[model samples]
Target: MPQMSPLNWMSLYILFIFVFLIFNIINYFLFLYSPNQNKNFKKKILFNWKW
Candidate 1:
């Protein structure tokens, strides 16, 4: 059996955090600029009828 070094564990934790942040950033931008979201909103507004 082998024991992991503290430095190695710290590096792995940092890497995981970096990856998680990048994933969230990508998701934010994708959702923020997604044409489909805007399209759906516009369609609803354009087709919504008020009597």
Candidate 2:
């Protein structure tokens, strides 16, 4: 069996975290700037919250 060194594990963990954050940021921008999404989405969300 083979095992990764502690430094390799740490770097892998950091890379995973960086990728996760970048994915979230890209998703946020897509949602915020997409032309198909508009104030209607916000209004619908607020309306649903009222229930």
Candidate 3:
């Protein structure tokens, strides 16, 4: 197999990261999140603390 140069590897890494970020951003906005529901979601995530 032909070895990739550092520049090629760097470009591939950056490309994958860029694609991953775009995918996450798309998924984030794909949901219809209202402020009220956002608050409700956060409230549900509260951990029950015990000492």
Index of the highest-lDDT prediction: 3
lDDT-sorted candidate list, best first: 3, 2, 1
What are the runs in model 2 whose C-alpha is more than 4 Å off? 1-4, 33-51
Q: Per-residue CA lDDT of candidate 2, range 1-51, in tens?
A: 237687788999999999999999999988895456455554434456666
Clashes of each: 0, 0, 0
Record all residue pairs in model 2 with backbone atoms less than 3 Å apart, i.e. clashing: none
lDDT (tens digit, per residue) of candidate 1 on 1-51? 236687788999999999999999999988896355454454335655785
The sequence of per-residue lDDT tens digits that candidate 3 reaches over residues 1-51 is 347687798999999999999999999999858775444454447677984
lDDT of every model, 2 decimals: 0.80, 0.81, 0.83
The reply for model 3, stretches above 4 Å from the true place, is 1-4, 35-51
Stretch of 10 with least lDDT, candidate 2: 37-46
Clashes of 3: 0
Worst 10 residues of 1 by lDDT: 35-44
